[model samples]
Structure formats: C-alpha cells, structure tokens
Target: MDDDGLFTIGALARRTGLTVKTIRFYSDTGIVPSTDRSPAGYRLYDINALARLDLVRTLRDLGLELAVIRQVLDREISVPEVAAAHADALEVQIRTLRLRRAVLRAVAKRGSTPREMNLMHKLAKLSDEERRRLVSDFIDDAFGGLEANPEFVAMMRSAMPDLPDDPEPEQVDAWVELAELTQDPDFRAAVRRMAEYQASERAQGDTTGLHHDLTEAVRDRVGHALASGIAPDAAEAVPIVNDLTARYARTFNRTDDEDLRDWLLTRLEIANDPRAERYWHLLAVINAWPAPPSLAPVFAWLTEALRAGTSSRPTTV
Candidate 1:
C-alpha cells in the first residue's frame, strides 16, 4: 500500500466512512489502534483497524453501550449473546410503548379531562401487583359478608381481568371501561346487595329460591312491558307482574296469594337495579364466565308498573 505498508488515517476514515475526528477518537480510546505511524507522525492503519471500526459502528447502532462494544470488539463475548440480551430488553420496551399508546387512545375516545387522563395513565402504567389489587378490591366489595361458597369464592379470586401482556385494542378498551365501572361507589353498593341475597339464602340452603329461574319469564314478559311503556303499577302491567309473582310463589312450595305477590314484588324491586345488571355482565366478561340473564327490563317494567296503574293490584297487606 503505502511506503510504510499502512494506510493513512485519512484513508482509513474514507474506507470506514467515518469522520477523521471519530476515527482519531477511536484510536485514542484504543478501539481501533493504528498499526504504525508514518515518519510524519500521521496515524496509520492496515485492514485490521478498518474492520474493527466497522464492528464498532454496527454494535453502536444495535444499542450496545460503549463498554459492551469494547468487550465485544475485544472478543470477550460472542455477538449472539449480546444480540439475544438486547432483543429481550427491546421486547419489554416495545410492550410498554404499546400499552401507553393504547392508553392514549382510550383517553382520546373518552375525551378524558386532565385529572382523569392522569388517573388513566396511572392505571395503564400499573405493575402486575397494582392491577391485581384493583380487581381484588372489586371482588372484595362484591363478596364481602357473603357465605363462602367455595366454588364462588374460587371463581371470583381466580377470575382476573387478565389483559395479555400484549393486549389487543378491544381488550384494552374493555379493561379501561372495567376499571371505571368498578371504581363507582354506587356500582359497588349494588353488587354488594346482590351478593347479600346469594349468600343469605344459599347459606341457609334455600335451593329453591332461584329454582324456577324466573329470569327468562321476567326478561320475556317485563321486557315487553318496558317496550310498551306500561308503568310498573299499570293495569297493562297486571299480567306481567302476576307472572313473576306466580313464578316466585311457586319457588316457596306454597300456592299464590295477594300477600305473596306483594312480597315478591318488594324483593324484585330491591334486587333489580340497572347498574347491577351491567356490573354482572362486565364481571362475566372479566371472568370469562357465561353471561347470566339480563334483568334490566324486568326492573324497568316493575318500576313503570308501580308508577302507572293498579286496577288489578296484588294487595300488599
């Protein structure tokens, strides 16, 4: 090559596409040491320094730290090992960014205020422990004071709203809404009341309480009442009210009576909140359980009937 059998620093820089300052810096740092110098004291390199500089540039681009790159260039570790470790780190970073992006989307969709957005960001940024705690609180509120039906308790605890580490768009949306619903005090109270009924009769071993599954009957009949705008106490509501009353009476191993109808109506009124129905539906999704029957229209009909008319009233006393 040259008279001294080495390329000049400028020549090495051109081959490496590196600035003279950078190549000089690497030389000073001992990463790509010059083989020898010309009599003019200019730095000199054969092919080896050029190759070392290329490896340095590649490793830097792959996010390797200077120390790591040094070890790599010194042959202290294999490239595959470094690449694998960096890949795992990148995976975690990518997942975190994806979750943050989803959080932004949810915020935009809801048009969340500043504080709400902050809270949302906090929730989305939760560690596994924090996320588990949120759901556990909801479960605790729903099941507190309830009889420890082993199956029920197990299902509640194990029924995590487990958004996958790499959650889909819909799952992220579900999780955000779920978090909001559970945070409502009214929703918490409603679920608590529902749990009270389950724990009480079931604990007392009243197997026949929901025996008739008046769910379908209520949904079908009361849904019609709601759709027709029949008030809960309207004469038009008589047939539907009587239907649920008759169904409830049958569960008690007793014949129907005016007093029985009144009692059933009272209980239904206590148990039939719209939000409670929604809470249960959401819980089904979070727990991946089969959906229980809906009762909103059942309550809606009862509410309207109570308000409308009483021509065929089932006497309360």
Candidate 2:
C-alpha cells in the first residue's frame, strides 16, 4: 500500500484528493470499480483507480459533464479531446454574454420603453441567415433594375452589411445601430432617395466621372466651409453651391450645364439625412468595410444655405 497499487477506498480518496462521499458516488455509478473486498467485505481499489479518479476529479472541475467524464474514463475520448470540445463550448458561452452586454447597452442608451426593448431584442438576435436576408432585401430595393450594370451592382452590393459569426463589441454595437436604422422611417426615405438617384444616374447613361475630381472638390469646398463655421444660409453659400456644381460637371467630363447642375443639387438635397450618414458608419463596423468620408453634412450645409440668404456662396470648380 505504501508505494505499490491497491488500497482501501478511503486510502484511494486520500491519494486522489477526492472526498469520500464523492468517491462513493463514482463507485456506485460504476465510474471507478472496487478491486475486491477483504474477509470483512471492506471495499478495496487497484492502484490504477487512483490515477483514473484523479483525472475524473480534474475533468469535473473543468466543467466536463458526467456523461463526458465517463467517456474520458472509458477511453472513448482522450483528455485533450474533451478539453478542446469544452473550450469551444466556452467560446459560444462568451459570445452569448457579449450579445447580452450589447443589448443592455442599447437599452440604457435609448431609454427603451417595453415595446422598444422587445423590438431591440428581436433585431439583436437575428441569425446570420436572417441578417443576410435583411441586407439582401435592402440591396434588391436599391439595385433591382440596375444589377445589369456591373459597376453599379458591385458598389451597391459591396455596401452590404454582414455581421461576423463571432462579432466584437463594436461590431455588435454597429449591428444594433444598423438594425435601428433599417426600421427608421427617415432613414428609409433617405435611402430610397439614394436608390432612386442611382437609378436615375443609370438612366442618364453613366453619371460616373472617369475622375473623382468633382466629388473630391465638392467634399473639399464643403469641408472648408464647415471648418470655417460657415452657416449654410450666408451669402457665401451661393458660391459654394456654384463651385460644387461646376466640380460635378467637370467630374462627369463636361462643362457646367445649368439643368444638370440643378438636377444634381436637388438630388443631393433629397438624399441628405444625418441618420443616413450614421447607417454607413454602422455598416462599416458590421462588415469591416473601409471608412468613407461623410457627404451628408456637406449637403446639410448646402440645404441650410439654400434655405437662407445669409450663408456664403458655394465654391465652384
């Protein structure tokens, strides 16, 4: 019994550091077998039972269920194999906790009423396939007729939001915001305007400029005005609009045409929505898409200027 193998059940528990009651449970469940009995019928164990018991104790502590523990003990699975499977299980658990955290965060941020909370939870729990269908529906609405245009289709589809299988906190936050955006009336209106604008561009037989100079110039001029804290209604607003219109014409490889300029300006106005800008931001996070510059603010600035008489004129290229 000193250094050899067989020992009494009590001795085996002491050797493996398991409680006597638990050791008895394992024996009763046939997990560890008693080697035999003395003349007095006292239970005894073989030396190998001590090692097996030690493994069982460790596995139990690591959260292996009783059935899996039995598997390991029976040589139906290796210890490492069990550990790996349980590790994956823990990852799934961690994801669940993370999602819960994000839900709580959104609720706190929105001061959600009961109905809102239920809606939030429903959107947050959308499965990958469901989320895909949602985005696909958006794209279909945006590009159904224009899918024949490879470039347009590519850009629109690339804008699709895809939440990862195991998303980070940011991605989760993005998804929540994106879901909110999709259900928002204002956002839908803005995106509808955008979709219609793109369709019009396709009908116009290629609104794309070989050079992005117009978009860049407009972005720069508007950016400068914003930096200067120029109010959209100031006298300066007109020049800014004219400049942007000219830039737009140049970008399309043409001279400034008043009718086209008016149409483009109106399109920008219609598509301008702060919430729409937010949609792109959240979409970037969920899909890990590249960051794009904000154009909505520029349109916002222009809108205010057009609506007022005090703003600076928009710069023309």
Candidate 3:
C-alpha cells in the first residue's frame, strides 16, 4: 500500500479483474473517483473507491444503466431500491421476449405470409382483457336478439378463449385463427343460425334432454352401426335407426312418426355443423382446455341414415 493507503489504477484493475481502461472510464465519469494521485500522475483509488467500482461492475453485469448505478453510488437511492426497480424492469422484458418468441414460432410453423404474420403478431400481443372483450363482442353480435337462454350465454362466456401469459406456439396460432374466425361473416352467420335454432327449441320447452338423448343414441348405437359397415339403406340398419328414433321421440315427448322423424332430421342437420365444432376446438386450444371428441361424425352418419330410412318408408295413401 502507498503511504496514503491507496492503490494505483493498475493495482485496482488487477484486484477487480477489470481492464485499466474500464476503471479509468469509471473514474473519469466520477463514478469511482480516485482518492489521490501518485507522483508519476497515475490515478490512485482507496478501499471505498474499490467497493464502489465493484458494485458498479456487478450492476452493469445485471443490465442496469450507468445512470441508475450512479444513483446507487451517490446514495440518491439505496442499492436494494435500485435493485428492486431493475428486477421489475427485467420481468417486463422477459414477458416481452416470451411473447415475441411465441409469435415467431407461430410464424415459422404456419409459414405465414407477411399479411398473416402481421395479423398474428397483433392477435398474440393483445392484453387478456382486450382478447376477452374481442371474443365477447363477437358472441354478443352472433347471439344477441336471439332467445338464447341465459344459461347458454353464461356458458359461452365462461368458455371465452384466454391466451396464457407465456403462450406456446400452438396457442398463438390458435389465437390467430380464432380471431379471424370470430370476425368472419360466414362463421358469424352459422353461429347465429345455431343460436336461433337453440332459442326456438328452448321456447318449446325443449330442455337439454333432447340433445343429450340424441347424442347418446347416435354415439352409442348409430356409431356402432357405422363402424359395422352397415349401409344407411340396408335392411340390417333398420333396428339401429328405429332404436335411435324411438329414444329421440321419447326425449321430445313425441311419437316415432314421419313428421317427428322429419323434425329430428332438421335438428340433426343443424347439430352436425362442422364450423360450429371448429369454433369450440379453436377456443379450447387458445384456452389450454382439453378438446372434447367431435360429435359431428356421429351426427352426420345419423343424418344420412335418417334421410334414407325416412325416404324409403311407405307413405300412407
């Protein structure tokens, strides 16, 4: 140690493992002022100066700005206070990076065109409340003025697609598709039609029992008939069709007659809509919900069978 208990710039660099130029820059900036100067005119630093330099280097390593570090060295803020602020800043940066990565991955997977990429980027960055509002508006536009029961509206609201804070690429892609789907005129029309159908049924006191029973009969009996390769018009499919029609009739409190079969066929036609199912599937993807197995195939099979059976049945003279 020199008589003044100070170390030269070179000595401080060796102790801190920082280059001499760096320490000189810090000293020049008055962040680590030297305690004295040697006779040879070399900058000299005491223990306090060394401690400040060490803190500055540590903060720089953690990505703090020089001005913030200066605040710490000048006691304008405590070290912990500056550290807490930087930590919050880093958290925001990390969230931004995560969203960027999700968008990039979605773009790569889709091989998205420039326009599509731009749309996906916007959709991916929407705040949670913004996303929810977007979907809610779509739902309101589709189902409003229709007599869709309150329970149905509540169910749709509860199933709103919410992108997670750190969404995966698939979730981002789903969000993009869902945003586009919700805005599509044709898709909105389809959902509106479905909502109108539901309203009409509910007005007649048709609770969920009709749909529940039909789904059960189609999935259980008709699904087996389809897998067994029974043609819709085949004599062997008669019992399966009869069984399903009977179950559906009982559920709707109607007899298994031609008019009832025709009404059932119309209901089945609407229930077999693929676009409606796609909406739910996309919603599940964005919200990270488990996708329910599609019932469209079963409903479609039943529709074909009902058409063939109802057409072939002898009409009373």
Best by TM-score: 3
Distance from true position, residue 264, model 1, in Å? 3.2
**Local distance difference test, per candidate?**
0.71, 0.71, 0.82
lDDT by residue (tens digit), candidate 3, 44-121: 899999888899999999999998888888889998898788889998888778988999998998899999888888
Write one digit per residue (lDDT tens) for candidate 1, span 1-317. 58756888888877878899988888899888989877888888987777888999998888888888888888898899899999999888988998888778877877879987787677766777777799899888788767734465576687667655665544566666778888888888776776787676576554553334667777777777677777675666677766566565666533535565455555666567776566557656544568887766566666556445442433331
Clashing pairs in 1: 231-304, 231-305, 232-304, 232-305, 232-306, 233-305, 233-306, 233-309, 234-309
lDDT of prediction 3:
0.82
- Indicate whether candidate 2 or candidate 3 has the larger lDDT: 3
Among these predictions, the greatest lDDT belongs to 3
lDDT of 2 at 177: 71
What's the C-alpha lDDT at position 205 in model 1? 57
Segments of candidate 3 deviating more than 4 angstroms: 39-42, 207-210, 256-258, 311-317
Backbone clashes in candidate 3 total 0
Q: By summed lDDT, which 10 consecutive residues of candidate 2 come out lowest?
A: 308-317
Range of the 10 consecutive residues with the lowest summed lDDT in candidate 3: 308-317
